[model samples]
Every structure is written in C-alpha cells, then in structure tokens.
Target: MDPRADSPDDAGTLPHVLVLGGGFGGLWATRALAAAPVRITLVDRTNHHLFQPLLYQVATAGLSAPDVAAPLRHILRKQANATVRLDEVRAIDPHARRVALAQGQLHYDYLVVATGSTHAYFGHDEWAGFAPGLKTLDDALAIRTRVLSAFEAAEREDDPLQRAAWLNFVVIGGGPTGVELAGTLAEIARHTLPREFRRAEVRDARIHLVEAGPRVLAAMPEDLSEKTRQQLQRLGVQVHTGDAVTAIDAEGITLAGRRLASRTVLWAAGVAASPLGSQLGAPTDRAGRVLVAPDLSLPGHPEVLVIGDLASVTQDGKPVPGVAPAAKQMGAHAAAVIRDRLRGVAGEPFRYRDYGNLATIGRMAAVVHFGRLKLSGLLAWWFWLVAHLFFLIGFRNRIIVLTNWAWSYWTYQRHARIIVGRPPPDE
Candidate 1:
C-alpha cells in the first residue's frame, strides 16, 4: 500500500479519526493506522513523543533531552493519513464525537484518548517543592542541576555538617525509575564525582532509596525484588522498606517518625492519569485512569477508545499493568478495531500477551522473568540493554544511547552533565 495515498481525502467522506496526546500510545496508534483509508489528526500539548523509560537517564546526566524525544510533526509528516496538531485537548464530548482543543474543535468518527499521566504527591502537593518528580524533560534537567549542584555545594562548604547535608541524596519510591536513579547516583558519588571534587569526600556521600512497600519493584516477582534490593544495598544505597514518608523539606525527609537530613530528594512514588480522562466524564478508578472495556473502548460510546497510561483495561480479571508494551499493544488493537469496522468485518476482542518484566538494578545486575523463565545478573543486564536499545524511537537515538552507554561503561563517567538554566534569582 502507498503510504501517501490517503492524504488527499479532504472531502470528509472518509472516516476521520482524532488521536489525542503524542506519547507512546498515540504515536503507536498513528503508526498502526498509517496505511488505513482514514484521515488521522494527532493532537498533543507538546510537539514531541517522549521515551519515558529513559527519562531517569536524563535526570542522572547520562542522556540529553533531545536524545529521547522526537518532534511530532517530523515523525508523522511522511504518513499520508496523519496530520500532527500542536494543541492541548481541553475536553471530549463523547455524545457528539467532538474534541475541544485550545484553538478549535475537531469532530471525529473515531476518537482515541491516549493522554498519558502525571506525578501525584497524594494529598500533600506542597511536598513537590522539596521533592521533585521526573516526568518531563524540564523535570529531568532540573533534577540533574539540583543533583550536580549538591556536590558543588559540598565541595565549597567549610562546615562539616553542612557539607554532609549537601552530600546526602534521598530517593523516594523503589520503582524502576527510582532504582535506576538511586543506583546511577550512587555510582556517580562513589566512583565518578570523587575525582572531580576536592576537600569533600564524594565517596562518603549517602544515597537513600526508601519504599513504602515491603520490597522494591513490588510489581515484579519476589525473587527479582529481593535480588534488586540486595544489588542496591551492595552499591552503597541505604534501602528502607515498609516505611512511609511523613514529611519532606529542604533539610531531608521524615520516615517512620525519624528525620533524615539531606539536601537532594527525588520523588518517584505515585502517578495520576491525565486530566483529559476526567474531562470526558468517563468512569475512572482511584488513580484517575479511565476504566475501559475489554477491547479498550468507552462504554456506551463504542466509537471512542481509551488506551495507554490514561486507560485501565483488565486481563484475567485484573487491571493491566501500565507499561510501554501494554500501551503499544492497546494502540495496535485500537487500530485493528478501526480497520475491521471500516471493512465491515467483525474482529476479536483485545487480548494482551505477557512479554515478561525486566529491570536493571545497576551496571552489571538486572532481572528478567518471562513465564517460567527467569534470568538475573549480567545476563539480565545484557537483555535489558538490548531490549531498551531495540525499543527506542529512532536509529539516531539508539546509536546515541549505545555510544553513551559504551563510553560510560568504559570510563565510569557521564557526558551529558552540563547544567543549563540560571539558578533561582535570589528568591
């Protein structure tokens, strides 16, 4: 099929599909439907598709912002059926099959709500000031600056207590992102930054990984979580489990009624669905995710579908896990549904295939489980690296990430460590 053949159907006779958000789900939906005979309009507040899994790398100064994001227009300009719109979707009128955007309204024969999610600080939103979460490129860069500046401050401070506080780094949550950040930061403090700082013992810097749950990577298998916890502990990260953070401030965090002094705190705890889900009046669960049917469609509104992190679909009577592969599968399923509907053919319901779960603890330690198959240590780490490299958006990104990883592995150093943006101007 000619990829550009579907562009000239401006007469509005063909089906018009509107996809909201340019993240993994929306981008995958557009790609899957590229060859279909439909007019596709992709709208997003930002003009880029972000690789969220690698966002921690940016926060740890291992990768640059542009290395993990691709311009939306540049990504879809070659597809005849696809048109990228830089607009924030304010609301969705499912009854009328219309989307309200900042500039104008768009009518769709089929609507795909792929709006992603944002970090949630539970009821204590004020804690965001002291503990920032990693979600956007700006967030990563800000974290990178704060992390690097702490070492700088420690090097210059004359008081031993003040220097110690500056050297202490605390990370909340034991998810994949938190584990990666804590491990990478611990490596930097113990190995990389010690050579760069004088008068201060960077190697003595304290890195803490706190989890409210009993173990890290709670979603993974028990053995994997235990292995990850052990690996992190070996890397000089103080792992605290079964403790909830009560408060956070510039000085440090309060856990189990005990106060820890630290200058840098990273939040990787919880997340809520995109506001777009609420705007649609769709039934949402506790996390604000739209509760979709087995086929990932809105009930009483078959033409409208919700997918990715913004949606909650069930398999085996349990909610599907929110991950990149799940989002991709949902996007592809939505596209298949649209194709079948257009061709007047009945299709099967969406079924998700378990592709196993993988998480890397540090440079040489990782874990992977697929069905009854399990792997760990160097083998799992190699698999993790290969899986991520293959899933990255473009060849350029893959090459850049591979080269950076190679360089870091060889020298134990990170290159994208430059601090941008001026410090806050005197309050």
Candidate 2:
C-alpha cells in the first residue's frame, strides 16, 4: 500500500472515504453522507458542478456558463465532514485502496468512483476536430462561437454556395441534446436574428437534426416522438431519421450517400465512460463502464463502489441509462450501503425508481412522459421549466436563468450571443 498522506488529528481517526468527480453522482453521494461518521473527501478536475440538461442552451446562446454551474467548494462549505479537492485521478489500486492523483496519492478506507463519460466517435476520433460535442463549459462556449461565427461568415460571403454552407447547421443525433440544439438553432434563425444581420437572411438558415434510429426520442412513446417531430417541423427544423452519418469532415457530413454542406456540425450521438474506469482493474463494458454488483460495489471489492456514468448497472433485464436521475439515485444508494456497513448490517440491493423522461423542442413546445401521464405543447413546456428551476443548485443561478428565459420569451432575444476566442468575420 502507498504511504498515507499527512492529515489532521481528526482526519486520521475517522474513516477516510474518497469520492471522485463532483458531478451529480459524486455530489449527491457526498451530500447524502453529510451526517455519516466517515470523513468525506470529494475530488474533481473541474471546480464546478455543471447542470448538464441546460448545456445545450449555453451552446445555442440562450444561457451563459455561470447560469448552469456552481463551484464545488461553495456547495460543500457548510458540510463539516467533507473536504473538496480540485485534482484529477490518474490511477486506482483497488487492492491497496489507494488512488493516484495528478498531484499525489491518497489512501482511503472506502472509495466511490463517479467519474462521468465523454463523447464517443465510434472508432472515428478524427471527426472530433470537425464535430464538437457539448460536454463541458468549454465545449459549449466553443460551439457558441462556431455557431455565431457561421452567421458572420455567411454575411460576408459573396458566393452563394459558400454562404449556404455557412448557414447550414447539422446536429448529429436525435437525442435530447440534438433535438434542443436543432430546434433552438431554427428559432434563432427565424425569431432571434432576423433583424440583426443586414447582408445575411438569417431566416434562410437550414437546421437539420440527423438520427440513426427510426425516430427521435426513441425512449418516449411513439405518439410523443411523433409530436416532437411535428413540433420541430413547425420550428423549421428538418428532421432526418434512419440515416446514419457515414463520414464527417471540415466541410460537412455524408448521410444516406448524400453530401451535406455544413460548416457547423455538432455531435450528440454517444458517450463512453471515463478512462479511469479501466484503471480500476475491474470488468468494464465496451463503453469502458465498470460492471458493479447489485449493491453498486465492485464484485470482489465491497469497499470500492462505482456509480453514475462509470457504472454499468441493470434492473429488470434492462441497463440503467446514464442519466442524471439514475446517477443521483446510485449516489444515494452507495451512501446508504456504506452507512449500513458501519452498523454491521448487510447492504440491500440497489433498486432504481423510474421518474419518467422529458425533452423540450422550442418556444413553448416539449414532451413529458410520467407513468401514464403524457403531456406536450405549452403545458409540458411549463412543467419542464418549473422542474429545472426547482433543481438548480443556487438561488442566484435559478433567478438569473428564470429572468433570462422570461426576457427571451417576451422579446425573442438571446443576450448570451457574444462570440469569443475567434476573430470576427469582418476582421
């Protein structure tokens, strides 16, 4: 075993439980164990816990980065038992119960791995340079620049073909991210920037949502999926289903053997679990997600638990999705199991509670599937808005987001439309 790090008197006595990643799973697990007897140490490469659902909004210029992120230290300031570390994990020695960090090694009595997933290119990683995915604040900002700059480029181009290429925006994937991005892009063309540009006809911009599956939102019911397609169509988004992207380059993508001329191509298709999962020396699936026991622990290492996108768990013969809700549930369950272990009681098997699914298209259009309660249109949109606001971490952030949404609704103007990092087309 590696040498233990120097610690305070209290930290040495209490059992040290190290949690990796400050995302939904790790944060929820740490917070759930607030009153537990163990000393908790939460480590993440990034300082902020991002609200991923609204990430597309940032990419679409509807919201800023701070509106959807909160510092990890600030969130855990009141938790006397928790210590936050801003560092990345390099390796994990399960037998030694030690995790090697970029800075130093840390020994733990118990370890919780919640490191999340990243974009997957399905054996074509080179495409990543051309098709950016929305996974972090940086990715969102970069996409926002690419999107806004596309319009600027179109305005200056005299050649019709080049202009059309600049105006064509393609989102590869029909999932929630793709749907939201494509729909919002369409809205920006039709409603937000119609009067902003003098040379470019923003309304003529084409927004295409490409999906490999037969329909969009395959998780929802067929009726809701059809309704989502119809709503996207109403927003002027071209929905292309059952056509897989065979190639992606700097200029555009090729789908169904047809060349698509687009400069802004966004990826939301697939995600693979973090590479840290493989370092655990545990069995992982093809996507690199560790396969944990029913109790959310490693098969032979009960002291090591895996949750969130890093864990490959299943219930009722179906794999649990890598969604925020599932990760939160797993985090809480891991805490419960650890607490139970302290009491000499065996931990119960983890059971997931399905809370339904939701996806917003545009303006006042959305879809909600809760049990038999299926809703769409304005009612569903309001439900989506209220639910998101209630879950936001900070009151200040919630207020800012709510205010932004209200202002955008009344005036159809997106204030977070500033382009950064890249030079303007005029320059």
The prediction achieving the highest TM-score against the true structure is 2
Best candidate, lDDT-wise? 2
TM-score for candidate 1: 0.95
Local accuracy by lDDT, each model: 0.87, 0.92
Candidate 1: residue 138 lDDT (0-100): 92
Question: Would you list the clashing residue pairs of candidate 2?
Answer: none
For every candidate structure, what is the RMSD over all alpha carbons to the true structure, in angstroms? 3.8, 1.9
| Candidate 2: regions farther than 4 A off | 1-11, 423-427
Question: Considering summed lDDT, which 10 consecutive residues are worst modelled in model 2?
Answer: 1-10
lDDT of 2: 0.92
Q: What TM-score, over all chains together, does every model reach?
A: 0.95, 0.97
